[model samples]
Target: MCSGADEKGGEQVAGRAGGMAALPAGLAAAPGNAAEARARYFNSANAFNIHLDPVPAHIFTAPAAAALGPEGAVTGYFLCDQSARLGCPWPATTPFMLARYARIAPGARLAADFAASGSIWYVIAGKGRVYGAGAGAGAGAGAGAGAGAGAGAGAGAGAGAGADAGVAEESALAWSRGDVFYLPAGASMLHADGPDAAVLWLVTDEPLLAYHGLRSARPDDAAVHFKAGDIAAEIERIHRSVPDAGTSGLAVVFSSEAMQARRNLMPALTLSLNTLPPGCAQSPHRHNSAALTLIVAGADCHSRVDGETCAWSDWATLVTPAGAPHSHHNEGPRRADFLIVQDGGLYYEARTMGFEFLGG
Candidate 1:
């Protein structure tokens, strides 16, 4: 699908390589070699569609502690909350963002504080124990192996107050590959290394208030709550629903426990798993609200934002800003699976108020 050229209707570039030629004048300078200059031109011209092919060689097996890019930045990776500095109070209490790739040794325990603006936890590799409130724990509710004892001490209080507190405190949830976990504001939680060592992509809006500071507020018990089984089971369910579902495209409103739990945390967040059939193209479309997409399976699938195109491999995350036009296409020969997170409530509200999706 090609769009006509500029307002003058002159011939415009088409495809990734050709698109690079149309970069804005006077913005072609780059810091390094010829290739870097080309990349810079491409990035400036089509920041949205800049694609990296063959995936970088050192990304997957590289150590978490190793530097991925320039100082204060991870090359080829985008961290959402880029302003946060380690060990400092969050610049803004409203919605600070921070992301880290942490590797935990097998059987080790890692504790973290809950955020003032809330948090989302995604497992990139390995497994681990996540501690938080049980189903009924409320804000300020005490938890631990001694939860029963702690509850008994407050049993004499009004039923409603105790129940409310319990619900608030039960914030931590279990997660694994393709699982996106959320902790509501004011909740304190922790995680322990799973049987095998684990690597986690931890994200939050508030980076200053850590788990240690909230230890006094933590319950004594640890909990493991949710788990998503093997891919075979998931694929089977999808196949059952759409017997002829061999083509690449997104399937929205599919049901799953993980999807339900995510919806509970943010009622507006829409959850879905998409399968992109090899060689299929998803033409450009825009969402009126912010969205987060994670590749769960397959590799070498490319996406274009505005006009930049890049191949995003499994476990890679792609963030689409609200109202930004974007599109995805399968560049590899295998099926690609992705988890899409979007603000469903916002979309509905925008549509009710008359927003339109422009197909490119």
Candidate 2:
């Protein structure tokens, strides 16, 4: 829930640990049916780029609390009910979810028992540890921890880290500044502590539950490991032959080209990393895929979607659904870097079903 606005000016609730509270007055409810609601939510201009302010602390209960370690950490989420909200017409069949993670120093913790259809972790700042599922483990094995002297390591067994004595021998994936980690369907993860640790986790609904189900079935199995250097190497390899897409200016084909390799890690999705030269304007364009853009560098860019304009800065997260007309112009004097993630399969499915795009 990163926003362009300050924390105090935006809406604030009791926070995540408060449990399921009613939607604020005038805040719309999810539609009676998912399909109709998704269509309305995705179609509404207001629904585009809805950003939630960050919650300051972690919220976990007794049963759910078992997943967290002894450290003082926060694990809350920003949920978008596609079936109820009116904005970008989200595909009725697709699912989505987004959440933020935070942890303090001196201790490592397991702060979440959740999963997603498509999950990504964006390191806003600071360092931390991440643990995923073993090759075999049931989701229910050691899912929670009780409040006690040894609660910190109580539920550290089964699929993810803390399982099996060999778990100690198992290393946790470490992340630093400007790093992004992608979790495949059914994978489990845990985060350790670092100096001033914090993270933004975005995920989809269906895949999350599926991964949990797999973990519940096989708790002692091992999982694959990756590092930030590994991701950087892949990016470098992809750009080795296609230097044009790496240019610092307005480029249309930049995204399409980067997808050439990114699609391998995420075969179900399409991704592009773009750089905007100072004072350049990106002509408005529309496509048939649900899209999300994260500002990696620079500042002062104006984004227009369906005639509504908004200012964007570094670390800002924006969303634009299928067939929605939008464009961006860099108003800053410095270059701007942005990352785009889209539903690749959905676009193919729509094209196969006869939905066509007329503008670029």
Candidate 3:
């Protein structure tokens, strides 16, 4: 049968075998037996151009507020779930990553047992320590926390890199506000808050792994920590070295020795600390990878995502859907800081990370 158009202008499949008209007439076959009944096929017109709901560019404020609430707030996770909007069965922020905020009351400990290949975390407030096989005995900012922690601990333990010889070889890594950390698969961790309540923003590629019906293989690397003080010093150095124009925003990318070659937090995720100087705005740009950002210090700042203004709130989790033209503006007196986790490494490895700066 010749291919033709239906009333809706969609290509018409020619055959109808037992009401199964999805395939071309030539390929359509009525189920002969139980084995053949299980088979299904579709032509170029219908099966090849599948479209799932586009992930929404959204901001989650209520969850952030709850996590950053008073000291008595319960210790739990406030997930920024968009599964309903994205038509995904599992909880997800973007299609690939799951973003959430965790609040731990003073001296309380919460165990995180996620089934992701890797997890990225940022401390929004208070102080804490992590205990787990993945938490290196002592590690600091701008240093490798995986296998390097064991090999280089002696030489690098000083000042910001506090020496913790008493800490078990498989537990206890101290952290504070502005700190960022990454843990490999199967690294179940216990987060213990200090004297004050703690709020942390976390993102992981659990949805991606779930979608693929795969589980992460047992991982052996320890957690890598980027201390607050070290990150501050690095940001200062970057601000001094960066030019006013002709460069990307002064962002700090976090990486460990195991991932240094790729300069990413994990095989499928990329983490960065992005900053917008006072009265400055990032040039409008777009990329294929979706971004899950934690607004850390945006007093009077907002983002223009695909022509829609998304006002910023402290510690809020913002989602920039893939391929949305967006720009960050800081109208306040101080600089705005945000930590962004993107599934860019997956695209980068696939050679499909289409990053582009839009022309005004």
- Name the lDDT value of residue 126 in candidate 3: 84
* Candidate 3, 1-360: lDDT as tens digits: 245535564645343232333544343277778877767667555666678998888999988887777767777677898889999888888889998877777765555556688688888888877655467644222221231111111212111222233456445677888888886665343445568888788888888888998867755566888998899998999988946665768998999988999999899999999988899989999999999988889889999998999999878889999999999999999999999899999999999999988976
**Ranking of all candidate structures by their TM-score, best first:** 3, 2, 1
In the range 51-142, model 1's lDDT, one tens digit per residue, is: 42211111222323331222322212123332232233432211222344444445443333333334455566666444433322332353
Off by over 4 Å in 1: 1-79, 83-102, 116-118, 135-180, 186-189, 202-226, 230-235, 242-248, 252-265, 347-357
Candidate with the larger TM-score of 2 and 3: 3
Alpha carbon lDDT at 8, candidate 3: 62
Please list the residue runs of candidate 3 whose C-alpha ends up more than 4 Å from where it truly belongs after superposition. Answer: 1-37, 137-170, 244-246
TM-score of 3: 0.82
Q: What is the lDDT of residue 245 in candidate 2?
A: 41
CA lDDT of every candidate: 0.44, 0.44, 0.76
Better model by lDDT, 1 or 3?
Answer: 3
Cα RMSD, each candidate:
16.2, 15.8, 8.5
Runs off by more than 4 Å, candidate 2: 1-75, 78-84, 87-108, 112-115, 134-166, 187-189, 205-264, 349-360
Question: Candidate 3, after superposition: displacement of residue 135 in Å?
Answer: 1.1
